[model samples]
Target chain A: MELADEAIRLADLPAADRRTIMILGHEASGIPSEALDLLDRAVEIPMVGTGHSLNVAVAGSLVLYKLAGLL
Target chain B: MELADEAIRLADLPAADRRTIMILGHEASGIPSEALDLLDRAVEIPMVGTGHSLNVAVAGSLVLYKLAGLL
Candidate 1:
């Protein structure tokens, strides 16, 4: 719970209080700019590796687990 | 924390008391038989969808986060 002020961990989110929706972008180009206009917030998985990004399915799965309080 | 009695969740492991190692298998074939001979336990992610399995990298990443107590 002592994370940086801006870092909102998925595990710490109030999953029971509200419905959650996740939008995963294309691994290479990411979500189109227009789609970005409809989202309420952005959530990013913290990574420290050299890979440019995680596979889109993997990213989506992780978020789903976190939002579902399964992780 | 009231998971199935047979389930030993990564989050419930005593991470602070011991070192943890994770071995990821090939995406298609999975870990070799010889390699399986050495591991002490098998952990599986519960899934409900029609996909046969998760992307290997995603599976590995999820385990790492759980073991690291970051999930």
Candidate 2:
């Protein structure tokens, strides 16, 4: 939350662009919807694991990789 | 290292595309240059703090923000 907020605040992006933001994770349930509203989209990554979440950097990397068209 | 490697492997990206990858942080010294060679660039974010590094997620978020042209 702090990281997202800081990124938005520091970047000073328009709300519309922020709305285009998509945060992908397996544990989307833990994140607040209001915060999701702050982003453009919030997508849950499909995964099956007793360990239900990925490291945040790994998650971010995956999302960026796809978004950057490197995937 | 594990995150980068996994991302690269899972994405099955070309080596040239991987070379464009940049890992930004305050502690570039700890990251191996060979691994960096796998990336196109490695940039160090300038900061002054007793705290040696940003959280990995935060660092990733910042890098994504800039690379995505949000910053």
Clash pairs of candidate 2? Answer: A19-A40, A20-A40, B19-B40
Per prediction, the TM-score for chain B is: 0.66, 0.54
lDDT of 2 by residue, A1-71 (tens): 22333243322322232324555433545556565566554444333347656566755544544444433
Candidate 1: misplaced stretches above 4 Å? A1-7, A14-20, A26-34, B1-7, B10-19, B25-41
CA lDDT, every prediction?
0.61, 0.45
lDDT of 2 by residue, B13-57 (tens): 222322245555334355665655575444443333486665667
Error of 1 at A46 (Å): 0.5
TM-score of every candidate relative to the true structure: 0.61, 0.34
Number of the top candidate by DockQ? 1
Model 1: lDDT equals 0.61
Q: Per-residue lDDT of B1-71 in model 1, one digit per residue for the tens?
A: 11223446544543334676777776566667676667665565666569877767777777876766656
Q: Please estimate how well model 2 matches the true structure, expressed as its whole-model Cα lDDT.
A: 0.45
What fraction of the correct interface contacts does each predicted structure contain?
Answer: 0.48, 0.30
Question: What is the DockQ (computed on Cα atoms) for candidate 1?
Answer: 0.47
For candidate 1, give the docking quality class from DockQ. acceptable
Q: Give residue A25's lDDT in candidate 2 (0 to 100).
A: 33
